[model samples]
Target: MRITGYRALNTVQEWGRAVGDANGVYADGLTEVPMVLVTTDEGITGVGMGPHVELDAVFAAIDGEDPRGVTALYDRMLRQMFKAGHAGTVFGTIGAFDTALWDIKAKAAGEPLWRLLGGRDRVVPAYASGLDIDLDDEDLIRTYQQYAEHGLRTAKLKGGLDVERDRHRLSLVRDVLTEAGGGARPGLMLDANECWSRKQAVRHVAELERTLDLIWVEEPVRRWDAEGLAAVGRGVRAAVASGENLSGLEQFRPLLAAGALDIVQTASVWGITHFLRVAALAHGHDLPVSPIGTNPVGLLHAAASVPNHLASELQVLQPPVGVALDLRIEDGAFVLGDSPGLGVVLDEELIGACELQPATSSFDGPGVRPERAGHRLLAAAG
Candidate 1:
């Protein structure tokens, strides 16, 4: 099929808070960007995230490219944006197109996205993410307990803010685990969201050594700090987990070569097409892939087929208000159905209702309000 139309819908959604991490508080319960690409003639449409500016740019890049040549079109669009830097802000744009292209391919094949990659597995393991870091320790523990009750065996907690307070919180989680009464304690992991310094990460890892049995400690330092990540990897007893912020496969080269991380979390940075390349490299190194994103999509499908995949990250929130698609979670895993094309159909009405208007802030980073017309990361600008 040929090209058709590209639309970027910027709408508000209740983004949950991530507490006790580099970002002091994390919540953008407002207009979030969603971009959708529609191909007519064949009447196939794909939906993904746009993060505002990047979505518009993606539309401009491949507005008329042949939908069948998704791989070629993806490369052409991505290569054109190279000089603009390859991480952070660029991913929002890249990820949008990636998901859309996958949608097109699946529609063409007349198969579910999961089966295109590999047949659906019984269930995909998940970790609880999007925990509001601002919650009190009691609240956090209670929340985790509730997840444990729901058959979730692995979960991620936020960290990298205050060393002392983080330690206390970790201890509380462990206490709850003991009280919950299981054969082995539920798997506990941490994501600092690029908040800590190398020194702080080292100290935190030393404290958690063999205590809580963390699957990994994610993004202990800033995203680009290869040396710091490597140092933490070498110094820590727990595995070093990262790679949610990198754009393409090339950016992960240094981290892998330097042996900076134990688990590599690759997302649909420009969608599953590039994510496969990153997963292949991580597999070659015998490292596990932990792709972060909620629900059943092509990205989740990629993780399910890859042998090296450890688990998938699921947001600890109900589906967006008015969303109709339901990807069920049972015993800490997702159940994918036999539906065609990513197994998700956007609730057009819901999408329209939440259409983004104007927001005081942008997705630049935590707490960084939009200034002028451009987005700014809180950590970098401050």
Candidate 2:
């Protein structure tokens, strides 16, 4: 079926506020999550949600294209991206189209998304994340304890601000795992949100290794610093994890070629088409890949299907506020069923009730405020 039309859902939702990571604070009890809904000629629709941006060009790229010809459509779009003129909106559009196309494709095949991707019925391992770094000691411990209680084997905490505080919190994360007792204490991860300097990352990692065991150190230096990131990896025993902010192979190539990352995390760069390419690239380098997103609608199936996937990163908070489906977690994983498409059954009422937003996530990052704007990142502007 050809894509008939597309609409963006840029609305203020409580889901954004209560849940967020180390990059920024999202709650004054308010925040906006941008989502896009695409409909096919047959009336089938799919939803893609992430950082919102202008996507007129993206819509133009997909209009009338065969929904099942997603990868072919992706090549055309990628080739035209330069003329289309920029990053945030481009990735946003691709993400939306990818989800919608995959949804339609799986539905047409009458199979669950995971199955369509060659997965037999099984749980996608999940890592507890999507936590607000602003939490205090008591609440932080309590929150992590909750994740362990939910059967999560791995959990991540936002870092790169205060080394002492980060160290203390990580120790507490280990404690929380210990307290939940049954088997081994849970695996722990840390994402710095591209906030630390390479030297700082090395120093902190050295200290942290002395105490808690981390599965990896995410975005430890500026995301664009391929060499610096590799240096940090060389200096530390802990593996370096990145790629949430990366665009695609052009970016992943240098990072991997330089021996920069030990683990690769991807989201909606060039949709699943490009993500698969990157995953294949990472696999060639013997790197494990995982998906990172505040909401994982477009990521779950693909993340679960990757052979070297450690676990799919699910925001520790999004479920409570709710998503398109009743995503259930069991034995530290997100389970998918026989439902066709992405298996996301939208809460139409929730989608309808959301207040229209003026603006949402920008290129720099999500949760960036008006006051925080007016700056470029790393070496240049995207």
Candidate 3:
């Protein structure tokens, strides 16, 4: 089916400072969210979440391309992106549109998106992420304890602003996990969110390791500095995991080939096709793959289909309204519905109740916050 039309929605929600740990200050008292729904000639449609920045440009490029021609279209997008100087925003569009394309293809085929992607397992492990350093000790303990009670065996915390504070709170995470686990500790990971210099990352990781063994340290130094990332990996006792912020395969290739990353963290922002491609790259290296955000539904499918794949990250706090997620958590893992395509839809009722006016200007999110994001941690503070 030829791609036909697209619709975009920008949503804003207020979870209050108590519940927000987004990277930038939502001084407008709202969080910005966006989604794109792509429709095909056959009337099949799929929804992908990301900013609607370049939907028109992407549509113009892919209008007549067969949605089923996945490989060719992907290559086309890559070439266009490279020509555009690999502009960061356009990559999000590429990822988002790729998702809608897969959704249309799978719906047309009458199979669930996961099965279309060749995934046998419908259930995928998940880790709680989106914690902010702004949260206090009690919030830290409570968050881990909540995860433990959910039967989740692992959770990653946000850190990297202050070495001593990170250690203190992480120690509390250990205590809560151990106590919640009946004296056994649940697995732990941390995202410094690329807040430190390479030297600071090395020293901080070493200090944290002295008191608590981490499953891995994520983006402790720089998100794009492969060499610096490699150095931090070499210095730390914990495994170094990154790539959630990277766009296309080019960014992943250098660090991955150099053994800078111990785990591959892909978000749905790269779409499922690219996700699988990157997974293959990591798999060749015998490293594990994981998802780093509340990714689109297609990503969970890719993770379950592969052997080295591990848990997906879900924010402890999603917008209290607007979005509808068909995925559920059972025993702390994500359970996908056997519905065709992604099985996610916009909740008009909730959206009406919760939606704020979309920001008129650009702002950063927890994912790209020049600062580490909030509310999940802010909620804990309350």
- Between the candidate structures 1 and 2, which one is better when assessed by TM-score? 2
For model 3, how does the per-residue alpha-carbon lDDT over 60-93 read when each residue is reduced to its tens digit? 7777777877667766776666667544667777
Q: What TM-score does model 1 achieve against the real structure?
A: 0.86
Backbone clash pairs in model 2 (N, Cα, C under 3 Å; residues 3+ apart or in different chains), count: 1
Residues forming the 10-long window of minimal summed lDDT in candidate 3:
373-382
Instruction: Highest lDDT: give the candidate number.
Output: 3
TM-score of each: 0.86, 0.88, 0.88
lDDT of 2: 0.70
- Candidate 2 structure quality by residue, lDDT tens digits, 126-225: 8887465777778777777667766776778876666677778887877777667665767878887765667777877788888778889988887778
Please list the C-alpha lDDT of all candidates, in the order they appear.
0.67, 0.70, 0.72
Candidate with better lDDT, 2 vs 3:
3
What pairs collide in candidate 2? 129-316
Q: Give per-residue lDDT, candidate 3, residue 57.
A: 68
Q: Candidate 1 residues 1-382, lDDT tens each?
A: 6667776654444654333334534334443445556564577887665444455565666777777677777787677676766456576577677677777777788876677777557367877764546667667877777766656766777765554566677777766665665656767777777665687677766776645577789888776677889999888778888887787777899988988878888764447777777888999999988887543256776777778878888764455444434367777677766666666566667767754443435533453422321122222321
